[model samples]
Target: MNTKTLVSICSPVYNGEDHIEDCIKGVLTQTYENFEYIIVDNASTDNTPSIIEKYRKKDSRIRVYRNEKTVCMDDNFNICAGYCSDNSKWIKYALADDYLFPDCVEKMVKVGEMDEQIGIVSAYRIAGRYVTSMGLPIEQNVFNGAEILKQQILLKLHVADGSPNTVMYKKSVFFEFNGFNSKYNQSDVELVFKLLDKYKFGFVHYVLTKSGRDKKGGFYYLVKHGFHILEYLDFGYKNLSNYKSISFDKDEMDYLKMYYARAIVSFLITKCAYFEWEDIKRMLGNIPEDIKKEVKKTFVRDFPKHIIKYFVSLLRRIKSYLRDKKRFEQFT
Candidate 1:
């Protein structure tokens, strides 16, 4: 692939006053300069537009466009991506609230330059607050395609490159899929899964994006997206309809179990945090009796102590907020 310009970047911004400055600086200051920065504004009420205007004036490469109306994150990203003129080689959606290392694009461009067939290139991300499920920052190594398939079947959760921030896709291939799902909140995961389904990805083996501020995929965002968990699960199962190998090797099956585990925890934590009993009941209602039993078995085996500590933590959190000293004073 004899590409003249190396890369194109798209950023989706929505009421992101807190971290937009740093996010822009991260891209503009990249050690790799042959790139276009496209900022897609989703009608942010904040001064996000002004900040973008400021950068566009300074750097001839930076471009900004506001969506006609508020669409979903996926559509905003796809729309912003379409705004890029480079369309030359590789593309990456840089989250408005995230920063990246200077060597980021340099390393990814090197990978794509060497390998044209590589549909996707991703690097390790430092999972931060709202950045990942892990409580602390962690690095993600590439999951083998075979292993990824196995994990999808077993875990029922698709771990497509740790963070969307760390992913870079070939521009041609990106548009080939018609971009992203504008309707679903969980479209990010869907986009990655569908991309991998059709094309092979090469792992870049470097740390790129920094979780600058908690934007998307934070605990609350996870709940909002994960609300459609069963829907996503059904989607995957529908796509892989002929998948008959329900039972696999012990190691593989054990790993798959965590998918169900995280799915449960993600949904449950949200319901528990907000005390949304009805939602919890609805989540449980979606699962079959067999899976419920499996869930119970999993709870006991994997997170017995966690379950106990969670309830205790919830009670403590609740107690701290409600100032009902009179009720306690009677007991005292």
Candidate 2:
């Protein structure tokens, strides 16, 4: 990588006062100097704006923005990307709560330049303090989108554990795909699948990002994150066949089971059992009798837990909605 190449690293955070400062610190201290660091304060009600302003003045490369109206995670991120320098052909979207390894960006940019067809380079994100996927590390490999996507679906793994923070892409390639679709609250998983057609992923294979979990205020965030999972499922199923995927084309039975498993698990986590039952029914409707029994068996094994969580989330949503209604009527 040339030392003179300009780069951009950014994230959009809502009420992210806690990590905003440290996140900027990590970027400013990066071994690479020819880059701009940005933080989009997406209408944070908390002290996040103040923190960002402090850093903005301290470093010329550090810039910040606050959305006038609150934007969801996906839209906010795209807004941050829109601010990247016009010369920035390589772009990155890091998380408000995640910091990169000192050399992460430098190395990825170098690798990106090495292969022009390589649309994105993903790396392992070490969970420094978060409980994600495997309670382990996720390493996204470097390969053409089609072959890697086959492995992703067959193993049923979120490609690179399914978050954009652990990856960097050619800015043009990402924008060509229209940045990211905002129809999903957590659409990054589906984004990987869609990108497979035109982009080959390059892997750096090191733990280059650290996501710190257990932020000070976590309870509400946990619920929101759970709900985001459903948004992901909605996107995945609606566009399932649209993805330019290289299917292994195993028996139809295996495909059926996987489809069922994906839906039920997503619904169970987001606590959207009934809301998503239509999708599950459609999937089950096409499967063999034996496969149906297996689905039932798998679902039954943890029936009690899923039921409890689903009802809890449903109740919470109901309560929140009711409270909002009461407040809305008073203002009107």
Candidate 3:
């Protein structure tokens, strides 16, 4: 792996004063040195700009820009993608709240370089205390892009690993697809599906990134921004089936129905718990009537276990809170 292919690390941040420095440092200290770091401050009214400058002055490879007007998450991400250097062949998103391990870029690039067809390279991530699930086990090291798209449609890959920040993609693929879709706030997952339709994916078995989540901000932001989980599922189901490259068999369609059923039910419960009826009504108003009916049907079908799991999840959160409080007290 002596080749020095230029990699562009882009981070689109808003009010990220708390973690922006660490994110920039993670990029600066990457074991792979031939890279450029771009940080887009989306009118952040915090110390984010200054912190970015603190490192920018020290490193010639770092570039910082501030947007005149704020933008949505997807738009912000698009801006980040637009900042990639023309010579950069690879684009890696380093979210402001996430930290990358020293060799993350090196290993991911290694996998991508293994084959000219590899469009995206991703690794297992160590999620902080707040992740809901790690997703279904992908036992293989390299996956056919189309097959992984099928897996995603079947909801077998339904968990946090689909994050764009955890993966590196070929710059050509990003541009060819016109980057992430802005219509869906959860555009990252959609982008992955589209990319997989055309290119192969390389999986690094090691955990190379540390991802963090906020318990409250997670659901609130999506719901407020009109990103319903049901829409994501419905969009994915339709998008994958209609995708010209991938064809699903009868067996796969059956499994897809089962997965969609479970997914709808799970989504309903989470949304119901986190949002008020008014908020759900306002945000979900555009959802089709048939999809709404299916949501109800699935909720009724899974009511018993849904209740049990809801309580169990609540208890787990309480336990986690207590454990964290005790750890903090120890430091005090």
The most accurate candidate by TM-score is 3
Clashes of each: 3, 1, 0
Q: What TM-score quantifies how close candidate 2 is to the native fold?
A: 0.72
Decide which is better by lDDT, 1 or 3: 3
The digit string of per-residue lDDT tens for model 1 on 121-180 reads 766667664333222113432333444544555544334545568778888888887877
TM-score list, all predictions? 0.74, 0.72, 0.81
RMSD to native, candidate 1: 5.9
Q: Candidate 2's residue-wise lDDT over 134-223, tens digit each?
A: 311244435677776655554454445446777887888878887777775446656766676667877775667777645453423533
Which 10 consecutive positions of candidate 2 have the poorest summed lDDT?
Answer: 131-140
Each candidate: RMSD: 5.9, 9.1, 5.2
Candidate achieving the largest lDDT: 3
* Minimal lDDT window, size 10, model 3: 129-138
lDDT of 2 at 123: 68
Error of 1 at 106 (Å): 0.9
Model 1 TM-score, all chains together: 0.74
Candidate 2 Cα deviation (angstroms), residue 41: 1.4
Give the true-structure RMSD of model 2.
Answer: 9.1
> Where is model 1 more than 4 Å wrong at Cα?
1-3, 129-149, 152-159, 212-219, 224-232, 235-238, 242-275, 288-332
Q: If ranked by TM-score, best first, what sequence of candidates would result?
A: 3, 1, 2
